[model samples]
Target: MNQQPLSIPADTQASLLDVLREQLHLTGTKKGCDHEQCGACTVHIDGQTALSSLTIAHMVTDKKITTIEGLAMGEQIHPMQEGFIA
Candidate 1:
């Protein structure tokens, strides 16, 4: 996990998923469909499930975006992750 907050260009027209993967190199969220139909791009935005692919990067500047990569704390796994395993 990154200790510092990511700073994306205000003028960037990339999708939230693109910036998360291409810029920050956080690729845990996969791109299934560019459309919002698939759950592969599902992530938490302020604790609510959202489709990253359908979200604009500039619009989420002040929001807390949580990708799959952000769920774990070093060696500790999140409860949701453990549930998926079980």
Candidate 2:
């Protein structure tokens, strides 16, 4: 398969968790085990909770991958995040 250049931020670490936390700066997604044992790195892939670490970076090509980053609009927080905080 031809590899496409995924536009993850330059400063992001190579790991999937690191990319989400550092580049996108979505700190809500925790990192309990880098081994993908714990469910802390859970995220919705095409509307299903998936272990982001197990997914290849290129697999998300042109697809809407919802991270903790894109959960909120300009000034609003996602209900899920707010519920956790509350």
Candidate 3:
């Protein structure tokens, strides 16, 4: 969640999900349908939810991206992981 802004290479040509999984090694965002139907690869951008599989990596450099890890606080479990353990 405290991740720094990403810099997408100009030559990059992949979906946000690809950048996250392949480049950033963020496997928290899952790919279900790959057709933008299932909500598996869900992430937040600027406090809003978006489908990472459909988003372009280069187009999100200016946005605030929050993955499942972002919702976790040291001792606090993320809601999606364990239904909001406080």
Cα lDDT tens digits for candidate 1, 21-77: 888888878899887777888888877888988888888776788888788888999
Candidate 1 ranges with C-alpha deviation above 4 Å: 1-4, 79-86
Which pairs clash in the backbone of model 1? Answer: none
What does the lDDT come to for candidate 1?
Answer: 0.79
In the range 4-63, model 3's lDDT, one tens digit per residue, is 765656436688888888777888788889887888899999899999988888787778
Model 2 C-alpha RMSD to native: 5.9
User: How well does candidate 2 match the true structure in TM-score terms?
Assistant: 0.62
**Model 3, position 53: C-alpha lDDT score:** 88
- Segments of candidate 3 deviating more than 4 angstroms: 83-86
Each candidate structure's TM-score, on Cα atoms with residue i matched to residue i, is 0.79, 0.62, 0.82
Order the candidates by lDDT, highest first. 3, 1, 2
Supply candidate 3's per-residue lDDT for 38.
Answer: 85
Best by TM-score: 3
Task: Count clashes in each candidate, considering only residues at least 3 apart in sequence or on different chains.
Answer: 0, 0, 2
The candidate 3 region of ten consecutive residues with least summed lDDT is: 1-10
**Model 3 residue 61 lDDT?**
73
Q: Is candidate 1 or candidate 3 better by TM-score?
A: 3
Worst 10 residues of 1 by lDDT: 1-10
How would you encode candidate 2's per-residue C-alpha lDDT over 1-86 as one tens digit per residue? 01223476433325555666776676777887767698778777667777777666556656556766567767898897786689
lDDT of 3: 0.79
